[model samples]
Target: MEFYSLLFLLLPFAALSGWWMAVRNQRKAHSLIFSRYQKEYLAALKYLVDDQPDKAIQIFTGLVEVDKDTIELHEALGNLFRQRGEVEKAIQIHQNLITKAPLQSGLRSQAIFSLAEDYMRAGLFDRAEALYLELLESGVYKVPSLTALIDIYERERDWTNAINFCQQLERATDKSLKTVEAHYYCELAQEVLNREDPTEAQKYLEQSILCDPNCLRALILSSELSMQMRDYAQAINMMQLVLGRDPSLFPLVKSNLRQCYLMLNTKSAYQSYLQSLLEISFTSPILIEITFELESSEGTESASNYLTDHLRKNPTLAGLSRLIELNTKLVQPAQKNDFQILSELIGSLSKDQPAYKCHNCGFTASYLHWQCPSCKRWNSVTPAVTK
Candidate 1:
């Protein structure tokens, strides 16, 4: 009986020893695999440092497996592919991540968002839109997904949908998007105007003004609508409201105001309005327009004299160019050639200069853009104050 008990204890110990040996061997194999993966990770980094992204991508794609442990690595590799403009590779990697059955909910959302970004970069906006909408429904990437959808709608010129997503985005975040929303309405108004539907366009412009009470574009559009309806007095009133709200927009409304006054047979009233603007500030374009009015009503010499006085007060290349033009008309036959040469030289210089510049990004353009094309900011592009 004693021998049998001792043997039984020995058997238990033997079983425990066998279990320990199996664990030890498994850990050793795991350590070797980890060390090998570590070496490949270092090699990938080295390739990246050498600016060889293709080789780095190859190594990283090989090193990273689609598991929860390697989720971040997979995302990193996918982003690398995207940065290198290897969008197909990025899509493939992210698509694989989403397809994995064991990926965590948060990680799967990340992969979907990344795939959507890849589609956007590839200009597959429809595909991107669908994915972003799905993410929106999931509520995992609410703000970012809404913003991406808004951008997609804007790119597609689907202003109605753009406005809808913009409103949702506003609710998702604390930031106010009223100005952007107003611009969307203005875009819709423009489309309506293009279709020769003035009444519907006016309704849209009215909504834009309701969105942003001080929307200069809406006010300008309203004035244009009035002019289209042949209500010159109402058009003048709308433009006056524009100047009252923001005098810096004088350049945009000056010609329209002049036409309204002309239709009302009120040239003197227009001159009086110009004089009032001069009292407030001396903008070169305003002064230049005044010179034209003066040349039409008064004589060329009088217009030249008036511009000379203003030029002395506020000298600008634009004002100087206008003065040269007036002098070109007034100079004597002997001095006409010299005046013409000077005018041409100034014209050449001014013609190449951009008329509008974005205060946000310093992007310059030849004509007015309510939104800066480079910065994509609304009401940021304004008349470049030439000097």
Candidate 2:
């Protein structure tokens, strides 16, 4: 009876021991699997760091099947695929995350955004537009979605939609997009002007100025419209406003202003205006225009003297080229050939140099661009004033 009682007491203890052993073995197996997964993850990261994306992508795709909790890892892999220009793979990955994975609401939104970016990279703007529109309802992605939609509209040259979305973006961020909006209005004005509707174009320009009082592009366009209407005085007033706002744009309007002055029969007034401009900013373009005026009105000797004095004050390649050009006419026949050669060489050099440079991105162009082609910033490309 004593032996039987002891065996019965030990039975519960034996069952408890078996349960503990099974739990330990199961934990060991789970730990080994986790350890293998960690090693594979590190190896994939090594492939990415070494710029071997194809191998990294393969490893990551396999890992995703084993672990569905890697939402962040999936995002990283999608970005990597996009950067590698593998848009199809990126789309597939993010789509799978959104549809196949059991993600919460926030993770699902993130997957959708990633897929939208993939579409953008692939230039599937229509598809990307749809996805971005869907994301607009999500608070976390609202601003970015609006911004992306604006970019898409701009690319499509859909100014109406661009302006509408821009207004929404302005309200969302509470920061002024007046300058960008002004540019949008100017774009609309340009389109109407192309369609031979000056009256409609004028309305857009007015709206642009209303948005930003100091919009240089609108003023210039308005002046151009005034010139077309044969209203010289109005054109002159508008151009002067442009100069007062940004004198660097003198190169753009110099010829127009000269023509307006001539139309008004005000040569003396134009000369006076040039002199005043020179007094304020002695740019090469201003000096060159003045020289041409003096040469035509006062004579070559007077123009040569005026240019020589200014050159002494502000030496520039353009000034030097003009001086050489003027001297070529005055030089003896023997020296004329040498002066012409030097002038040609200087002209060749200046031709290769860009006339405008973007302050935002260092992008250079031969002509003025109100918006930078590279960085896409407004009013960034300005006259390149090389010393």
- Winning candidate number (lDDT): 2
Q: Which ten residues in a row have the lowest lDDT in candidate 2?
A: 1-10
Per-residue accuracy of model 2 over 1-387 as CA lDDT, tens digit each: 332232233334332234334434554354333455766766665665566767866776665443333455567667667877889889877887787455556778888999999999999999999999888866659899999999999889898898999999999999899999999999999888777788999999999999998899999989988887899999999999898767778989988999999999998899889889778777888889889999999988889999999889888889999999998988899999999999999999888778999998899998899879899888899988733
Q: For model 1, which pairs clash?
A: none
What are the lDDT figures for the candidates, one per model? 0.79, 0.81
For candidate 1, the lDDT comes to: 0.79
Task: Say what the RMSD of model 2 is.
Answer: 11.7
Q: List the candidate 1 regions with Cα displacement exceeding 4 Å.
A: 1-65, 101-104, 348-353
What is the C-alpha local distance difference test score of candidate 2? 0.81
The residue ranges of model 2 lying beyond 4 angstroms of the native Cα positions read 1-68, 101-104, 138-140, 348-353
